[model samples]
Structure formats: structure tokens, C-alpha cells
Target: MRTVFKNFLVLAVMLGTFTSFANEMLEVTPTFNYVTKGNHISVSDAFGEVIYSGEINYSGNLTTLFDFTQLKNGKYDVEVTNGFRIDISTIEVKNNIVFVTDANRKTIFKPVVRNENNSVLISKLALDGEKMDVELFYEGELIYTETIDGEDVLNRVYKLDKTLKGSYTTVIKSNDRVFVKNFRI
Candidate 1:
């Protein structure tokens, strides 16, 4: 029995290490269409609105099915939309990209990390004639910054602490137009 127990423990540890090693980073298209027409458009695309996971009765982050299991450490095609929020570290490699969402947040963002620090710092640039106030959220904490001109778009910076599993969301507002983008794990 003692030998069996020791073997089981060894197997568990070995399996864990193997899984970790096999784990790869996912480069996702955080946004399919940033500014399609109106509010919730990008959000719909990001979460697959009423398409896969069920449109009417099920309002779940439809893209939840497309969980990040699609890519390895290579370059994966990503789509940057109006409200691009992706916390790149916590990706679940399924058949597709299922964002690893915050337990408390209805929304999720997979922010990409440049270094081992796992700190995802994003840069924002606007387009031709759009005025937007981009707001960033990390694990329920709100950090906001505004951008007036699309050409003169400013950058907003925020960090996700370790204890909180680096989930993010973006809110872009222009007068009566508002776009909300979130991640789903």
C-alpha cells in the first residue's frame, strides 16, 4: 500500500509537470470588429453574441467555446476591435478559445504578456474621425483615461496583480455611442 501511494504521488507530480511543459501561449484575435456600427457589436463578436453557445436563451460569452486552445507559441491571427481587452496568460487550450474569466466578473480580457513578469501593458491608437474615452478594468478595479481625437488618441495603462488572476475589460464611449468588450473564460 505504501509503495502504491508513493507511486501515485510520483505520477501526479509527473503529470502536472508534463501538462505545464506542454502548455503553450495563445495569440488571440481579441476583437473581430472594433467598430462595426453600434454598441454591443464588438462585445457580441468577442463573445460570439447569439451564435454558437445559443443566442436567445443563452447570453453566455458565446466565444467561450473558442477558448484559447487553438494556438501554440507561434503567431496566431488576432483581431483588434474597439474595446480590445484580453488577459493573455490564462488561456484554456481547448478546441477553440475559451477565455479564462474572473470568477467574480461577468466579463473577461486576455491581456498579452511581453515578459516573464506576466504584466500585460497594452497600447491604444485611434482611427480617422472618432472620439472615444477608453476605460480599462482589472479584476473589478476601474482605471480610466480619455481620448478625444481618433488621430491624437492617448494611451491608458493598468496592471493586474498576481493574487488576482489578471482578467481585463475595456469600455469605449463616444457621446451616445458606447462599446463594451469583455473576456470569458
Candidate 2:
């Protein structure tokens, strides 16, 4: 009876440890839909090749840097998974901008600027209750700034100044995070 009780106690402890590890939630911050450096993350290309992987070292806000500055622009799958739960984000990097979405192409935040009929069109979409500050800088000078309020889904389109002939930088701030993209006219 003593041996049986000891075995049972050991089993209970093992099960408890397994359960605790399995229940750990994997959180990707600055938006789970998009991944940059400083997030505990693993990135794979479309061919299932692991391009980048890193573990979070900091305690607060999941700030761990994973460098992708030398990578070529393309679609990649980012995985932030614990032992039990797996979260994947599909992202495309183009023109210094990272466009991120879920498996179903549901974007968390999407921003696009394109030339339309000799004019530049700037469009952005954000999730519900998300506040965004969009700023356009021309030649290092602030050209325009727009603050978007939180709504169920926020969408905005602005016509950019086509006459500003040079490289422009768009800075987007949302949810206490900032994203910068540079484009040329």
C-alpha cells in the first residue's frame, strides 16, 4: 500500500507539471497579426523553410529582437506557438512595409499607398476600437497627419501630394506601437 501511494503521488505531480506547461499562453504583441523584431517568434517561408527563430528574453511586453532586415521581400509564415496552442500569421513584405493577415486573409492593420491616375492614394484599415495616427513625411518634413478614432472597423483614404517629388515616409502609430514605411514617388 505504501508503494502504491508513492506511485500515485508521483503521477499527480507529473501531471500537474505537464498541465501547467501546456496552459502557458503564447502572446505576440504589437499586434499578433503582424510580427517585427522583438517578439518571441519563428518565421518560415512558404516552402516551410525556417528563416528566423528567436525566444523572448524580456519580461514585459514580449520585446525580443529577431532581425529580418537582410531578408528578401516575400510572403512568410510566422509561428508563435507553445506546446499546446499554435498561432500563425501570414505576412507579406513589400516596399519596406509588412502586410500581415491571418490564414483567412483577415488583416489586423492594412495600409497601402499607390499611384492612382497620376495621384497617390493612401488607404488604411484597422480593427475595431483601434486608434491610429498616420503621418506622412516628405523629404523629412511632416506633410500631413491624421488621427483615427476607435470604431468597429476604421477605414480611411487620403489623396497624397503628387507634386512632392522624392521619397516619402509614412509613420503609423497604433496601440502604443509605431510602424514606418518609406516609398518613392
Candidate 3:
């Protein structure tokens, strides 16, 4: 009985290893598109400079592929935005070949930041329970900063000081993505 149990355990381990390898081999090449209007795709280098930009003019289900083989070997980001959530795929190019993994892909829910009268309203649909950091800057100085966590939906209202009339900047960060919005008081 002891020998039989050991044989069964070895077979189980081998099957598990094969399944993991199969999943990795089945990963598809990343494609950029969405079923809507204003679909924009941009590929940026490691230094945050856009190298290639394209737009899908028509509406509905469509896809546009970016040739990664044309780029030099380095790390890059492929971003697709459609006035809503942003999908970011981080790829590494080596020897003129692009390598992508599922672990480096993420989707960021864009927060709605707008000024209503003297108050700034910020709202986001964080269904994935992603943490967010919000910072308020006045005249290029950090005034207020907060870390939001453990919520499916994030909402906040900040009443700007009317007396200090200057430029205001709101920065929201989530899942390694930073969004900045500038306004005047």
C-alpha cells in the first residue's frame, strides 16, 4: 500500500507540472481594441515617451495590432484607452522579439475628477478593490495627501480654499498608474 500511494503522488505531481506549462504556452499575444468609439492605443518606452500612437476611427468590435518586432530591445508599455478604463500591457523586447506575460497586465479604472463650484468631486468604480492614493497640490506644493483602501467604490469631495486663488492639481494613483488633472481656482 505504501508503494502504491507513492506512485499515485508522483503521477499527480507530474500532471500538475504539465498543466502549468500548458497554461503558459497558451498565452496569446496582446492585442489592443475595444467595442466603442474613441479607442486610442499608444506604445511608450521605458522613459515614458510615446513611440507609436494610433486611433480606431470606427465604432464596434475591432482590433489594431502594433508590430513590436520593429522596435529595439527594451521594456515598453502598450496602453489602450476608450474614455473609460485603461488597459496596460507591459512587454519586454529582446533581440527584436516582444515577450508578454499575464502577470504584467492590468486594468485601471479612471477616476472622474471635476470641480463643482468651489468643491472638487472625485469618484471611481474600484470593483477590483485596488488601493488608491490621492494628492492635492496648490501652486506646485503638496497640500493634502491620503491613501484610500478596502472599498469597492471610492468617492471623495475636497472643498478648495477660495482665498488662495491659484492653480490646483489633483493626482490619483492606482495599480501603478498615475493620473493628473490641472485646474485653476
Candidate 4:
């Protein structure tokens, strides 16, 4: 009788363990819907073509659904952009099946560019130790280049030459992304 009781207890524990593991695995299953704290979201292809774009006008945990079935069998990127950072996730589609996981997500900080009068101020939060490249161009000619890193926040200010000025362009590059700002002095 004791042997039978022990076997039943062991079987019950095994079943409970299996159930817990299965529940954890299903937590990340792709339901094509999720709650986001972002304002704008977009889905793009591998060739840098935007497939779908939407804006979240309301606040709070709003659930959004993206239909991946309309897409072809390939890999795609979904980007959610707030004011300061962009969250990216790569989803794969195979044989009309969509796969997504929280492990395949990344965030990129965006540079803030402001042009006031003749002074240009650029600021970025350096989180992932990625080097930022600041380039200055005058009349389509690259004149200055500066690479910045090793700080919590990267801030740069350039006061343009008030005399020699027709058109000026400031290009900020970081984390394989580029931002261009143009101004006239």
C-alpha cells in the first residue's frame, strides 16, 4: 500500500511540473496582439520598406493587434517608437505561420536635434556603448566629423559661422541609424 501511494504522489508532482512549464511557455506565444507604452508603431520588411504603420493616440495599456497573415512568408521587423527611444522586434513567418518572442526585442535611443538661430544643439543618451558620429556639411561638402562616446549623455553644440553660410546640414549617426537636420544661417 505504501508503494502505491508513493507512486501516485510522484506522478502527481510530475504532472504539476509539466503543467507549470507549459503555462510559462505559452506566455510568450504570438497572439498578434500586445500592450505597448509607445505612441507610434510600424511594420517593415527586410528591404527597409514600410508595410503597415499606426499611431496610438490614447494613453495607458492599449492592446494593439497586427495581422501577420496578410504578409508573405519571410522575416519582418516591427518597430514601436516613443518620443525618446525605439523598440524593435523581428518576427519570422514560415508557411503562413508567424513567430514572435520577447527575446527578439531591442531598443535604440534617438538623438535630439535642435536648431535655434545659428546654433545647433544635439543630445543623445548613450546607453549601449555605441559611438555617435557627428558630421557637419556645408553646401553638400563634408567639413567636420566627430566621434563621441564614453559618457552617459552625449551633448554637442555647434555655432555656425555667421558670415560663410548658405545651407548647413548636421548628420548624427548612432547604432546603425542616421538623422539629418538642415538649417539656414
Q: Tens digits of per-residue lDDT for model 2 on 1-185?
A: 99999999999999999999999998646555433334456788979899877775543422224444445788887766443234566777776566665553322444555655435465555554677888878899997898878654444555666676788787877655576778777
Q: Is candidate 1 or candidate 2 better by lDDT?
A: 2
lDDT of 1 by residue, 1-185 (tens): 99999999999999999999789676664442122322232122233232212112322333443344544432232322224442122223345444443332222222232222534344443433456666667666685565666444444444545665556676766533455566422
Window of ten residues with lowest summed lDDT in model 4: 26-35
The sequence of per-residue lDDT tens digits that candidate 4 reaches over residues 1-185 is: 99999999999999999999888844453433344544798889989899988886554432225557668988888887878888788888888778775676888888888877778888898777888899999999997899887776888888877787788888988889898888777
Candidate 4 off by > 4 Å: 1-40, 45-50, 53-64, 72-74, 94-98
Candidate 2 positional error at 122, Å? 3.8
Evaluate all candidate structures by whole-model CA lDDT and list the values in order.
0.44, 0.64, 0.81, 0.79
User: Which of the numbered candidates is closest to the native, going by highest TM-score?
Assistant: 4
The TM-scores, one per candidate, come to: 0.28, 0.41, 0.60, 0.64
RMSD of each: 18.2, 15.8, 10.8, 7.2
TM-score of 1: 0.28
Which is the better candidate, 1 or 4, if ranked by lDDT? Answer: 4
* Candidate 3 weakest lDDT stretch, 10 residues: 27-36
Ranking by lDDT: 3, 4, 2, 1
Please list the residue runs of candidate 3 whose C-alpha ends up more than 4 Å from where it truly belongs after superposition. Answer: 1-37, 43-51, 60-78, 88-106
Candidate 2 — what's its lDDT? Answer: 0.64
Q: What are the clashing pairs of model 2?
A: 38-64, 38-65
